[model samples]
Target chain A: MTAIPVQPIVSMRRVEKIYRQGDSVVHAVDQVDIDIFPGEFTVLSGPSGSGKTTILNLTGALDNVTRGDIHVEGRKLQDMSRTETSRFRRDRVGFVFQAYNLIPVLTAFENAELILSIQGVPRTERSARVRDLFHAVGLDGLEHRRPSAMSGGQQQRVAIVRAIVTNPAIVLADEPTANVDSRTAATILDIMERLNREMGNTFLFSSHDPQVIARAHRVISMQDGRVVGDERRDGNS
Target chain B: MLILMAFRNLWRNTRRTAITLFSIGFGLMLSLIFTGIGDSGYGRLIEGASRMGMGHVALIPRGYLDTPSIDKRFDVPSDLIGRIQVMSRVTAVRERITGQAMVATANDSAGAAFMAIDPGTETPETLYFMDFLESGALFDPKNRIGIVIGRNMADRLRVDIGGKVVYTLTDVQGEIISGLARVSGIFRTGVLQVDNYFVLLPIDTLRDLIGYTSREVTHLAVFLEDHAASRSIRSRIQACVDEIPGAEAVTWRDAMPDIAGLIAMDQSSNYLFQLIIFLLISAGILNTILMSVLERKREFGILLAVGISPLRLFSLIMLEAGWLCIFGLIAGLLLTAPVYGYLHSTGIDLTAMFTEKPDVGGVLFDPTIHADLRPISLAVILTVAAALILLSGIYPAWKASRVMPVEAIQSA
Candidate 1:
């Protein structure tokens, strides 16, 4: 008997991105093609200036691709208007920034529930879901604390919980553990790995951290705006 | 949640919000105070003129305004007087006869305005003469030929109280008439024209001297209970005048167009001054809001990345500006209330500020200026404040909405 191929959740075909500064044109992302399957804990690894963050930005629809088609859940991103793209991101994708960019004025619970609020979820359901997620992320008692009052690791955990509280199709985290200590980074990785395993939540990360790269189920390595190595690992190893 | 965010955002920088509030509050306070003082000053000017025998309404002969000759006299309608006297709000109606004449003492001569009034019927308050008398009575019922002269006129003519003077004018038959009259009283109203040129006589004596019959007079001055009710009262008097031939009722504002124009100019200039103040306030608020929006570019980028549309972001910025303006308006009103109350009650005395009281439309003004609070004026000011705040918010909010998440997050 022949095995059926699993359909990818996000597909990129010959994606290219170029930037113009003054009179010079530079290729920030070359014709790179890749597919990310559902429930895959993937990492895009590259040195500085190797287009890892650029690819993350493109995949999340934070920017437009110069020449190529990118689809999320089989919906073409290039065909959407600016407003439509925003709505698509709001409903379908979540993001975690390297800086843990929580709103300074909002408390931890508010920051974590912001995506759910933006999605127009009811107050009661949002409260319940955010509370459960906060407990799961080990930030149970710090719900009312603002970002400035929290440590770097705690802020990132809030960001992580915020990213998944809306039940998005995928989460794109850019250097999620870059600002934390080794112990905190390991904790963050453990939490994200558990969510991926238990809830079938897909996560794509851009990082240069060796620890983050070592835990990924699939690691796509890039050099000079092009993917040089694509490695896939089976369960745990 | 958006409102909560906006309100929290405003206080994130306490000093900036305070300064913005102070600026708005100060501007509104100045506008209120200036409006109050200006209205009070203009109100006094109008009142002074109205009390100086212009009254609230006047019934004049058809051609007397165009030519002040003795031939322009109209016969006084007794029934018309009875009808007007019975009307509500009508305080007094007095007969008057005015003509240009020349008066001479033994040593000097000057041109004078002769005003013939019925002392028996004319109220002293209506003429505003009882309080301003320097030496003698307004008019004595026993003295038919008694004349009242202003202090300045007395000085110019070199005449004293109880002195005899000769007045000469052309009568209705085009014949020259002369009369000898005794000065019974002298007044100093501080109005240059009235003090220098006015001469009052008994209406009956002037009618006889000018060859007028028993019921002939040049005009009828109508006084009202409240000067502000002049427009409605004038309409009623106008209807009565229409029933009588060769009579027309005119309000004080219509009788003195130049003074009315002056008051209008004063109001318009006050509005212009307030506009200038509001412009300055608007600029300050605009600067503060724009700076805040610029500083929050990265935050706006994060908000956008979380799927807040550009329009929503714009609304958030505007909401912040609205909160700032509301705080400012409240602070301003709170700070101004007590000061306004004190000024309204005690008034600002200009007696020490000026050597001579200001005069307009042949009437002397009181030196003390009291603040006037009218509901319409307050409404206008509040509306202007609201508009200025909204106008100041537009550019900053638009700029915030236009921020691109990619560039904003990546810039720094």
Candidate 2:
């Protein structure tokens, strides 16, 4: 008997995202096909002008596709309306912005639980989830501190907790460790890898740092808006 | 949580929020005060016109307002008078026979407006003119032909207390009738029109001279407890007046258009001034909201990137404006209460503001003005201010909601 085929959590075919600047045209993301399966810690490693973040944005429905088909969790990104895409983003995918964009007015705990709250989760359950994730990330006693009051590593750990608190199907992190020192970045990467390996959380990170790329289960190296190589370094997938 | 965030956002710059709140609170306070002044001023003028024999409302013969003549007279029964007197706002109901006549003494003759009143029914409280007598009494209770003339008319006709005079007019049959009267009182009202032309006499004497019964007077004056009550009572008594053939109930406004029109014009000017202040306050509101939205575009982009709906962001901004409105109104009420109370109780003497007491259409008003803060006026100002704030909030909220998350996040 044939084993049933594994469905990809994210599927992209012939995706093209172009930009027009003054009189010149830019192919920010050229025609490309890629698939990211469940529980795979993948990284799109590229230079500054490469299209790794664009692909991540398209998958999370943060930006619209110029021309192509992208399916996250088997739902077509192009078929979703503005409200539907918002719900899809709300329920299916999470983001870790490079700036650690925690709302300055809210405490760290409040920031971590913000998405679950928006999803109409009960207060008790949200608190329990946020605390559980905070403890897992080694941020046990810093829940009440705001982003401004915490160190870069603590804030990023809180951001990671925020990203996966709802257990979304996928987490898109763009240059997540780009702001801090190398030591802090290593700590953030270690925490993210621990969550991925131990808890089976899928992660798709975009970064050029060799440290981050080395820790991924698979690395998709890109250059000039085109994928140059795809390598799997582990047997997890 | 959204409300808490919105409320907390306002104090990011405490001084700016305080100043904006002050503008709103002060504008609302000024609106309240202006309304109070207009209400009080109009009340005084309307009462003055009502007490000058036009009453708050009157039951007059049809076409009498346009062409008042004894020939067009109608009679109202005693039971109708009693019924009107029992109505909600009616204070006193009295009968009168008014006409235009010529009064002459041995030295000269002058044209005069005659108001024939009943001594048994008219009092100083009912007839404000009776209180301003410079000399003598308000017509004789015993003498049939006793009359009261203004000081100017008395001077013009060369008559005084117990002075002999004669009045001539055309009666209902189109025949000229004459009567001999003694000037028993002289009044000086400081109004040139009234002091120069008015003549007061007893109703029975004019009825006798005109050859008419007690019910056949020109009109029945219906005084009220408050002059503004005429608005409702006139329509209410119209059906009752419709029962009497050829009779109609007329408000003091329709009876005395000169005073009513002037009051209306003054009120319009007051409202226009208040509208300018409200527009300025709205501009301030727009500035406050727009700045707050513009300063937080990146934060909003982050929110949208995460999964907060655009509509929810819009609601958040609107809630911010709503909080401003609520807080501003609280400050306004707290600021205006003591000032309004002082004006209502121990009013400011406006004698310094004017050389003399203000007069409208020959009606003298008080120099010391008081505020009348009607409940409806308060409700209307508050509602209007709240509506203006919400209207001003829409543009900023829309701008914030329409932010492109990618462009915004990348820009910063």
Candidate 3:
């Protein structure tokens, strides 16, 4: 009867973000407190207006916190400059969006290499990593295929590989299967799940789909900028 | 690799890229032609003027430059010519006796200025004179009172070679001394001022006619091995003259201030045109890059999502612009060579642009114009155009960097 360790990879304390539109202020994310733990499949489930994406943004350090302390892997998000934030994102965070936004001009291989290239990873290491990533995503021979040439499932898988190629601590997937068929969506999910289990990487997915939520070990449900439910499933599956 | 990426991406949107490149190329061509024509015309004018009596540097009596009259004509020592001859870089020195005179040819008589010089040393400039005879030789150094008249002056006086002309002028003593001169050679330099106003005679004879000793001369013209060394050599020569009484050394530029000013003005105008061209090309390139960034918003977002730094993204976009500009530069150079070559060979006629003939740097040039087609000019223009295009991409690259990955992906 040992307790499972709740090691927080990302922590937010009373964070608030407001958007100015015309004369009124809209609260995109209100004063909230949360912690996302390492090596956990966490789902943020909410309706369209539930500030799910805003929370994801604050977690990823893509946007500045309006009025609170945010620590990612023990690094203070509010204290980082714009360049520092970018470096943090580069070294620590990976993002997969609903659109599977692969660079159209690059093939699957080149798309993955873009991240490592900017990181100044040597060519030999990059090649080996890209090769391994392609094989892991079950796209071994499709490295030369451009986004337009690949199917929706294949493109999403490419994006997943692109995100994880830098060996980031967490993968933030924002409605990653929104544009794919059910069959393709399930395959994408399977690939992402295998990556999380094998790499021991944290996965924070923002989705309202029941299928997506069912796969996560921990679920945090939100409504009106507030978490309404937080649940964790045992290892029994 | 960045350049390769940029080139490939630009080709993805060929029409837009071509238009951008066209703007750059057109600007480059315009600059080349304008600069080429300007440099050539001005260069030739200076060369032609230098070939005349000026010879890069001129020496005159100390106060004679301020007021060049008969009274200021000082007695230069006999050693002056020998000293100037042996000076470093002195290619040739010609002594001339200049004075005002009233002369009556066979048919017409008019008050005019006279320059007496050795015919042997006058060959550098005398060839351009309208009165120069293609058929007959110039007056013998032994001919004391022989003269050469301009075609216009000849027409006015109705005199030809071997014809006797009477010249009357007062000496420095204000006593009218009349002399008879024979026309040795008829000339036409195609310049109206020199042809109509000034006549050449033997230096010795003119000295005798003006009652001047051999030590007296109005000016000495010193030609140099390299005209560009004129300023430094003029300084050295000026130092040498400081040791001599009543002597001063001045460059041809000092002798012709209006001509020197015209050259300076043309150079400034050339720089202005080059600046305008740089701005024009930069704007065109920036517009193209902005459009490309706008068109590929999602792509940039994808790059950002995958951990590409904003600065790296900025570099990629700018690298793309640099490639486009470089392509345009190469294409421009390729197209410009033949066009410049053709212009250089056949020359452009300025008659269509000017009412009469354009006078540049005191030399009246004909309507036919030439251009200098040097590789250095080409390289300079290309480098500048490339720099402008690269600089123009910064703003568009910044705009591209501002694109949020979520918005871009969702919008796409």
Q: Compute the DockQ of candidate 3.
A: 0.46
Model 2 segments more than 4 A misplaced: A138-144, A197-199, B104-109, B123-125, B134-146, B154-165, B179-186, B224-229, B346-357
DockQ metric for all predictions? 0.59, 0.65, 0.46
- The CAPRI classification for model 2 reads as medium
Model 1 has a clash total of: 0
Task: Choose the strongest candidate by lDDT.
Answer: 2
Each candidate: chain B TM-score:
0.83, 0.92, 0.81
| Residue-level lDDT for A218 in candidate 3 | 87
Ranking by DockQ: 2, 1, 3
lDDT tens digits, residue span B104-195, model 2: 99999999999899976788657878878999987656778898999989888888899999999988788999999998889988777888
Instruction: List the candidate 1 regions with Cα displacement exceeding 4 Å.
Output: A1-8, A115-122, A235-237, B55-110, B114-127, B134-148, B154-186, B199-253, B264-272
Relative to the unseen true structure, what is the C-alpha lDDT of residue B190 in candidate 2, on a scale of 0 to 100? 76
Give candidate 1's error at residue B15 in angstroms: 2.1
Worst 10 residues of 1 chain B by lDDT: B122-131
Q: Taking the tens digit of each residue's C-alpha lDDT, what string does model 1 give over A1-237?
A: 999988888999999999999999878889899899999999999998889988888988888999999999999999998888888778788889999999999999999887788778999999999999998989989999989999999999999988888788899999999999999999999999999999999999999999999999999999888888888888332
* lDDT of model 2, residue A71: 88
**Which candidate would rank higher by lDDT, 1 or 3?**
1
Q: How well is each residue in B12-58 modelled by candidate 1, as lDDT tens digits? A: 99998998898899899999888988777776677667666666788
C-alpha TM-scores of all predictions: 0.84, 0.92, 0.86
The deviation in Å at residue B184 for candidate 2 is 5.3
Which 10 consecutive positions of candidate 3 chain B have the poorest summed lDDT? B126-135
